[model samples]
Target: MPVPKDNRPLRSPNEKGRYRRAWKESHGNLLLAFAGLIFLIGLAMIWASPPGTPEIDVDLGTVDSADQVVSLPPNVILIRVATSQLNSEGPIRIAVYDSPHTFGNPEQAIIKDSLVPIDGFVVWEIKLDFLPEQFAIAAYHDLDDNGELNRALFNAPVEPYGFSNNARSLVGPPTYEQTIMQRPTESTAIEIRVY
Candidate 1:
């Protein structure tokens, strides 16, 4: 099917104002109330969610490096996210752990970068809802946008990446326990560092 063109001529400021105000007064409150209802319904739907939901919540306050919410609510425990605005130079590092090592990777990693418009350096939060027990969480930092990590031609990952618990990177990706965590009830903060 052909897509419709939204090329209708622009409206005058006065015309726009009148139409917007009328709609606002007529539908604003109703819209808000409807949105509230929907949010509540979403929470309620969790009651029917699968039995594998994992509960996770953490509070890191406001991190200066990057802003992210990693914890999950009770009903919807599992969540997924991606980081972006990385400096290909050396800033493409995400530390799920500060000491042991970091986890995740940027080699053609999806989300975050593609979804956002960036400048200088920035990390985006890609909020996803899932059962805590359904999927594993791996937050990777990509130094470059190429589909694969830098290799020495020997095919070893040339970038520094880590998993949830510094789970060693085997052949492909790590397993759930290797990178998964108990869902958080509150929001947790993770950072994207450069290499």
Candidate 2:
């Protein structure tokens, strides 16, 4: 029986050789190119990822000579604040408030505020002035140095902020009552960390 003809285009006698040549020219480098692309993407991902946890130390110096020496009352308490997981972008701003009405407005309710510079990475300390019996603390890593906590359009904080008792909120900053820390002693130290 006679077989059908394919009716394809004419080809060279070394048809296999021609195909090999074409494949080598076009696709042989494709695998290598794809591998290079994958390697580049992986490098970028690694570079963009956050580094491991950091370690930090703080230095507490005497009060500035220019500041007046006011005599604190007997009820005045010395509160020491230690923070962890801090970034080195901006100074750490801490404020103590005596009332809930001023917790939301540090400018109005801040009994005493201090801006501590971040000399190291993850840990730092701030020695607060004499505080009253009832007080709450709010702190943040002001990455922008604007002296205010920055938030997104939805009011989500762009800066890393914390409160006494390490208070947190779902939609906004925590309330003063929620962050109040009371100690029976004359001096106390509170620790806060930011991820």
Report the lDDT tens digits of candidate 2 across residue range 59-175. Answer: 223345786544433433444344443445577767778887777677776454555644432222333344456787777777778888787766666666677777776546678
Give the best candidate by lDDT.
2
Show the lowest summed lDDT stretch of 10 residues, model 1.
94-103
Per-residue lDDT for 67-177 in model 1, tens only?
764434333322222222333443333323211132243342332233221332334443334323222334444556554456654364555444454455335545545
Q: What is the TM-score of each candidate against the true structure?
A: 0.35, 0.52
Cα TM-score of candidate 1: 0.35
Query: All candidates' lDDT scores?
Result: 0.42, 0.59
Instruction: Identify the leading candidate in terms of TM-score.
Output: 2
- Model 1 residue 138 CA deviation (Å) reads 3.2
CA deviation > 4 Å runs, candidate 1: 1-60, 63-134, 169-173, 191-195
